[model samples]
Target: MTSPATPTGSTVPTGAESADAIVVGAGHNGLVAANLLADAGWEVLVLEATESPGGAVRSAQVTAPGYLSDLYSSFYPLGYASPVLAGLDLDRYGLHWTNSPDVLAHLLPDGRAAVINRDLDTTAASLEKFAPGDGDRWRHAYADWREVSGPMLETITRPFPPVRGGVELLRRLRVGGALRLARRLVVPVRKLGDELFEGEGGPALLAGCALHTDLSPEEAGSGVYGWLLAMLGQEVGWPVPVGGAQKITDALVARLTERGGRILYGARVDRVLTARGRAMGVRTAGGGLWRARRAVLADVPAPALFLDLVGPDALPPRLVEDLAHFKWDGSTLKVDWALSAPVPWTNREVATAGTVHLGADLNGLTSYAGALARGEVPRDPFLLVGQMSVADPSHSPPGTESLWSYTHLPFRPNWRAEDLTGHVERMEEVLEAAAPGFRSLIVGRHVAGPADLENGDPSLVGGALGGGTAAAYQQLFLRPVPGLGRPDTPVDRLYLASASAHPGGGVHGAPGANAARAALARDRALTGGLYAGVIGAAHRAVYR
Candidate 1:
């Protein structure tokens, strides 16, 4: 399985057999890291186990020939706003985006809907219908978002212990406002809603966004995610790739290949080969070894990288113990449909929105998340729906529509096919209640349960979407582990470049960008030493 090495440590020239850096898994982040390194003149090689790249950010026409459904992810607000992608100008590489007139809608039990529009005033006015004076509260909250949005996003995406982001936030908010913002960050979404507005729409909208992760509306630190994502919709509309989600990944792969980087499909990395406690390269499942002269960036989940590939024996005992406590997020059940007609919503506002949240108000949302936390399947599950045709007409034939909906479930170590079918039926009933005769329009359908998703992409371990739980104990500095939140690993030349790392999931390439910056810095001996020392000191301070 090993490649021939010369006396001078040169490769035997097996065509992409050697590179300055090797990226495992051709996910968006992996490809992003590869492109960055290749742009820097490093001979980068990317390995993908599947027949294609784009681990989760891919599309399929499972329902019908003309229907393009985003198999995993669809919206790209984060991708559009990503600083790394912005610098790359992926538009030139064929990543055109399309946005709906309205961003999202939260449909209530009574058929009224709360719509989030790109215009702040319009969104505020919509909230006014639920309660008097709520429009002002909405505007006030948006003003706070304006103050901290830049700094908050920078802190999330940048390297850990964001000193620069802290300074900028403090400068913008001043001491009092900054302190208030800090307090809000720790409050539960439920409490945040109560403090801000006295209306169902205000609270329901926030809770709906919080459910995007595995967190309950009552969980501490859930408010931040809810606020952040909702504000992102305001700042940058939840845009979809013109053709499909695959366009984003396709563009990334194109840029990488154009920069002379190579991608090897069907190369499943079986193990990460190490020498003297440093990553050397990877061995594929097909008994072929590729060498990396500088670094190996693993864009797979942390458990897959550490437990399965690297093995517990190779990790420090403390890290191995910590890995045991690693918590996965909730499992998912997704249903994609090729409809003969658009969803006939009871509320007209719902028809205009690209995304919809169904079968939940504030209390229901909390209860649904709480049920998952208690390892129980929710009787009335919360649904996240994507109207592909409404967002971008290219998703299906004219007048026809492509739609998908998904809901979270507690992790069942051994989920069965019958269980998924039952859940799908329950979801159908929920949708039918909201949109009468909804099921009649379905010309074709495809269902992906937890096992199906995991089989398709192991990164969604047990179908936990955000790489892991976004609970207070498992987010930010403690994400993946209690280690410093950078991509650098205890193993030299090995970096964690997956969504399982800091900032945890979404289409943002921050984890990959952070890993590449670390590797790039390491290539410079003096800068590497200094950066390593600083990171080590920070790690000690936190862990001590």
Candidate 2:
């Protein structure tokens, strides 16, 4: 195991034959895993297929030179809240976060908006304008969330090895916290929010937050996401980097390198070169064999890694079947707007907002979901709009604004070029209905369909951003399939360190942290506990 010369950006060809560990993708998660391993003396070498390190973590001047757009994951409430990320010391590596006063503003049909101010009193005061007591409901959920969320986050984000984390979480969280967490996690977001608030905008707020991952409010497991995000927003508030999302990645890359980790950007790993039941290394797509003596980690999704990259002979038969049944999260189509000015809102108040939601109502969100299920792009799609210029001034030239808005469509759409164009049109219509003349604000716009997402990185996998679906059926240990807790697939030491694994998605490093913990724990003989066996059996079954 050796730490070789620092390999530069995404174009460095790999001629090296061996390293301490060879990670297959330089996604933020892959880089995070490599850094953690390197910090523990693993001599990590990350090989990315792309010409750059940031996978979905990239920001580009895709539309114009002076304006930058975050390609994916613009608002990072979840990323900011993850405990695993807290320990990484990202701020020390040059990444900084700025919190806006009003975190979210959801526009309605009547030109009225539900604005969530960072201060609870301010948010409640605003809610009071919509209806009475809705303010109190906001207060209750926020206060309740403050009590039990810490342990709940730990259980959800910690490693799945033999399921030890769950047991430990229950042990650490008091009886009341455990009960509250259980009751909160099981209900539907629609039901939960409706039960709590008595205002015109309460359900709309819940629906908007829940749909961040494009999950309908009525969907199973919607409660967890909706509550976590909304409550977290009330707690820490949502923050973004000063320039764009790229600052987060740049900080991560700097810290990883500063900690003695080696990164190679352009060398794409074609396969994990394995022998027998043990892990060996990765061979770059261009015929360079970069072998890892300790472990071969893949930041790739489960399907691509197991079915496409590793041959069928490498996996168990049951896992082969599960791979076919694995559900992928819906694909994302993005539109970047380089605006001459802010989006012109009919209400005028939303123009200066940090983040705005565009849709009709809760019905509009439901309509969007129903249409997607029928393979039709929603006639009234709910779009998450980020006015980056409002959040951070450096995104554009003075008086100009950089805006990004995105929405989810079904994984397989009967899309011609018009289907995508039509979707964008519908998005504009919804925005226009909420904020009159939104279309007129567009100075330049760049559209990315599934093809464009694939062009950016094959890892988006048909533009499914979270690697796979975030629905209840695919979550937890069932994620990417049931069996293996480690990112390692049934194919020996090959691990799935992407967002598709347990503790799924977002810009958080939990999946990568989980994988690295598993790799190192194996070496340290630390995962031999009994709870681990159950977690292992579950992992093996899903992957089998």
Candidate 3:
């Protein structure tokens, strides 16, 4: 690695390019943390291993020139609705939203489709097409969402255990109401659909959303993920940043630079420097040492932070043992295309949708999910199709469409390179069934398997999108190997600020925002002591 000369700026302090904080990765979450810290008058230095930041949020013309495809994450309902992102005022920095007429459509085998729109009544009417009385159930669930979604989103997006949100939700729902809500939250998406609606349409819609996470429809705690995304789709239409996903990173980088923060691209931090059991600085692959006066936040996977950077020798024995059992979501295969024309969906309604979900039905989704869990690829795969041009005309050249689709594969697939080709072919076959002559519309195509995805973004370990599995046992307080369930790591002055942190994965910048608050609190002696005492007590109560 080549160690280049350190640059200069007022934000760059005297010794070793020092700053108030040193962020190890320049993913969206890392940028979010840096921006927040700099806004508070702290000198921040963000280091990225890649030549550019944005991690998986960046977009490119992989298929052909002028065909912009989001490299990884595409839809961002969470980004639109996230309170943390909202506070950042990204729009002022040149981020624009492009929304489709409908948020999402799930096409079924019977030629019927379930569609969700921003308008509640319209979405309800769509559900009515599936079953007569299911529309009423849809409205009832949304009515409940109106009462609790704010607190629920606040709770998940904030710190763990969500004490305040829990209390506020309890107050709104009452004791009996809260118990009922808990039941709904704990069950599998399949069970939730059965309990709430009698129609296949409503349940299928929910089950399709659950696939967005690694969780299968039958898994506990998946119902919440399904409920939240579907609710948010209805509340805030899924949107993409105008121009491309890169615009989001461009806006964030601009905001950070304006606030006097510096980002060092091509600086790969190899290890976290520690003195007296506290993080002091980072030693880069390029042999550069950057010190931090206050904190070091890592926007990387938990295993990378602990296993690679911190090392097992420095961590508590229990935590290290837990690391061995840490699970990963299934690997994924994604395909992007520069289409000669828009996808001609067999279902006319699906043609107008921003996102189209195709699984024969609930059974098809469940079967594919089960196949992944069993270390096998499914004969028939579930497809999540995004019509980028339909959502935003600027995504492609005039009259052309930029389209993409992805399907999950077994995390540890015992396969060959040829197997990946078969998977891609299978994915196309599945799509073709839904949209006849889809392959004929493609002018150019690109595919990324698990290896390609991980090579592109280290945080997407084993191609797990959420940074880790979203199973009930590993979520909430147990996330990223338990302990306090907050940003603070076992090592003082080092914080975990990535999708591996609380609130799991999404475009939402909660992990970064939450870590920033923790770091700021620690920087202030008053809040630091109080937070430490509480977190220490929480660790003793839970882990000890």
User: What would the per-residue lDDT of candidate 3 be over residues 1-544, giving only the tens digit for each residue?
Assistant: 1112332111222467688999989899999999999999999999998898898899988999889999899999999889889999999999999899899999998789999988889888999977898888999988888899888878878988788989999999999999988987889999888987888888988999999888899999889888888888988889889888899899999999999999998888877877655788887886677888999999998888887877766666677778788888788889999999888888899888899898669988888898888988888889898999989989999888999999988886234789889989998988888889989999999998887887788788777788888888787778887666798887777899999888788988999999998899878866877876666556556544
Q: Write the per-residue lDDT of candidate 2 for residues 1-544, one digit (tens) a residue.
A: 1112222112212455777778888888898888889889888888888888878887888877799898877878877887877788889987788876578888887678887878899888867778888888888888777766676677667766434555655676667766766777767888887788877676777778888775777888888788888787888778888778888889888988887777786787666655664556666766676667777778888877776556556667787777788877777888988888776777766776678887758777778887877767666677888888888878887888898888888886234688889888887777767766667877788999876887787788777888777787777767877664456555445567888888788888888888887777656655534434544565565544
What global local distance difference test value does model 2 have?
A: 0.76
Give the local distance difference test score of model 1: 0.86
Predicted candidate 3: what Cα RMSD to the true structure? 3.9
Q: Model 3 TM-score?
A: 0.95
How many residue pairs clash (N, CA or C atoms closer than 3 angstroms) in each of the candidate models, in the order given?
A: 0, 23, 0
Identify the runs in model 1 with alpha carbons over 4 angstroms from their true place: 1-16, 529-544
Q: What's every prediction's RMSD, in angstroms?
A: 3.5, 5.2, 3.9
Collision count of model 3: 0
Q: After superposition, how far is residue 1 of candidate 3 from its true place, in Å?
A: 21
Q: List the residue pairs that clash in candidate 3.
A: none
Candidate 3 ranges with C-alpha deviation above 4 Å = 1-15, 413-415, 533-544
